[model samples]
Target: MTNYEVRANIRVVFGDGALNELPTLLERHHPKSILLVSSGDYVDDLGIGDAVRQAADSLGATLIEDRGVVPNPRLEHVRELIETAKAHNVDFLLAAGGGSAVDTAKSVAIGLAAPEGTDVWDYFTVGHAVEQVPTLKVGVINTLPGTGSEVGRSAVLTNLATKEKFGVEANNLRPVFTIVDPAFSRTVPQHFQAAAIADEIAHLIETYTADDTDVDITDRLLEGALAGALTNAAKYADDPADDNARKQLHQISLYQHYLNFDRNSDWAGHPIEHVISGDYDLLHGEGLAIVTVAWLRFIAAHKPTKLVQLVSRLYHVDAVTFSEEQVVRGFADHLEALYGRLGLPTKLSAYGIGQEGVDIVAAKVTAGGARTVGNYYALSQEDVRALLSAAL
Candidate 1:
């Protein structure tokens, strides 16, 4: 077995009613005032802002709301959030809602700590001089389970001007505390729920297949997460109010979030999805679902062994009876069917992407460097185009 290292530092409080303990956790961090970060829509729809305000009051911490975050959070939003934090003299950052909100908080935290002369984009796209600033710890009341942004150390930000999305990572980027309450997800519309599940499944599949690590524990955890997400996805699609299904999906999302720690996974699909979303403003999960089937087919041809193992472990199939191609292809078919069942478009054209759109997306993905990173087989621009073509 090869050597592997695992590290989990976040203080995780998981349960059906985890949000109730947010006040205590905030007090433990000793925050005098907190910037409550969220998307404007979720704040009103989910009443997350009100809940955080109440928690802050109970804990004797002043709350400042910054609620303009959107899907594929942008760099300008981070800068604005940093300014808000400074103006409010916030000692802590509280992120509420889904991945976009949590990711925005992480970027804000890093931007505030960054030196005045430095640019935040440099930290994301290119290595630049950065130092951890002394104030502003991070916490989350996660309303969505996808993206695992609450516990992960990296945040994905989009450059709206350039239509590029990239990641930024640092030890200090992880949240100080995260409150995951599955009950909050009960109100998520079935369409969003399906999209979230697609994104979560992509995370598990990419991580599980990317590296050649012999980490048995991580493998089991990844498989369990995929199985749970798959099962719950079907149940939740049929009945969004099923508390049991919602809980299971939340746990699986949380599990995938932590599993990414200390593990090297291919992030190819994310960049591709980012391009589609940035260019077309398509839903993040919907874009991911469209690309995933084609990406899996490419991976199956290039890394048959890994695909076979994943199928055997995740779907509980006997490898001896199922040929590698059949297993790999079957997994792709299953995912396509699932996406269809959940009312997500399975084809690129379904989202208004034709042959020319495919070419544009392929070129952008090539420029993003996803073609080389985390790929078991280095994929060329032609391969990407072919994948897009097949997706159509």
Candidate 2:
């Protein structure tokens, strides 16, 4: 077992009626001004706007609502919100939707606190330390659960001008509190709901593939989470309104982040997808669904041992008798079927991406004289080209 320090600082109010706790949670901060950040019409459709207004009114705080955050969480929008927050003297930021909303609010909070004349993009590009800046407190009413941004310390943003997507992490970026109400989750569009489940599965598997060490407790916990996630995903597919499954799925996403305590997790697949989504404005989860399979195939070919272990543990496959190649095929086949069950497209061609698109994205992945993206596999520029080509 490796030495690790757990920073479990976020206060979580989770359950069926968790949204009602918004006022109580915000009252603890006693802010005079609040910024309610969200994506699309969910704020209006779900009555989240009204709820936030009521909560702010109850606390005698002035509320500024920005319901314009998009799916990819653009840097341009973050800049606009940061200016809005600064102008309003906003003391608190409330994210009222999914991971995109949470991340936008986080970017604005950190951007607002950055030193004078400091471009917020520096945080993502120039290794700016978020802890160095004094950021406004953030709270989340997480209506969508996949990315786990409500409890996570990292935020992903896309720079449309540069066609660059990147993430920044610091303990300070985490929400001070998160309210996970399954009722709100039930209102999510079925497509996004399926995508969210896929995203969580990818997160768990990505972390699991980081190392093949004998950390029995962590490994078991990860396997259990993956199993539970898969089971709930099937129920979700059967009936999107399965209340118990929705609630459990949300819990699985939130809790699984804690399992990466001492592991050097691999996230190579995400950058590949980030480039695709950043350039073409594709859904993050959708791109992930396609790229994750290709990434696994890369693993199966180059580093079969860890993937073989995952199949043996999760699916009860007899790796001892079967060849590694056979185990690889089983795992790959199983994942394709699972993605099919969720109604996700498994090929890049499903999104109209082809050889030319692959060439462009491959170049972008190794841009700025960079050699690789992930730590576990250390995929080279050529490896990235090959990987995207394989997905195509």
State the TM-score for model 1: 0.92
Q: Give a tens-digit lDDT track for model 1, residues 206-225.
A: 88775556567778888888
- For candidate 1, the per-residue lDDT at 185 reads 79
Which regions in candidate 2 have their CA more than 4 angstroms from the true location?
none
lDDT of 2 by residue, 62-133 (tens): 999888988899999999999988899999999988999999999998899999999999999999889899
How does each model score on TM-score? 0.92, 0.96
Candidate 2 C-alpha error for residue 206, in Å: 0.7
State how far residue 209 of model 2 sits from its true place (Å): 1.0
Worst ten in a row by lDDT for model 2: 366-375
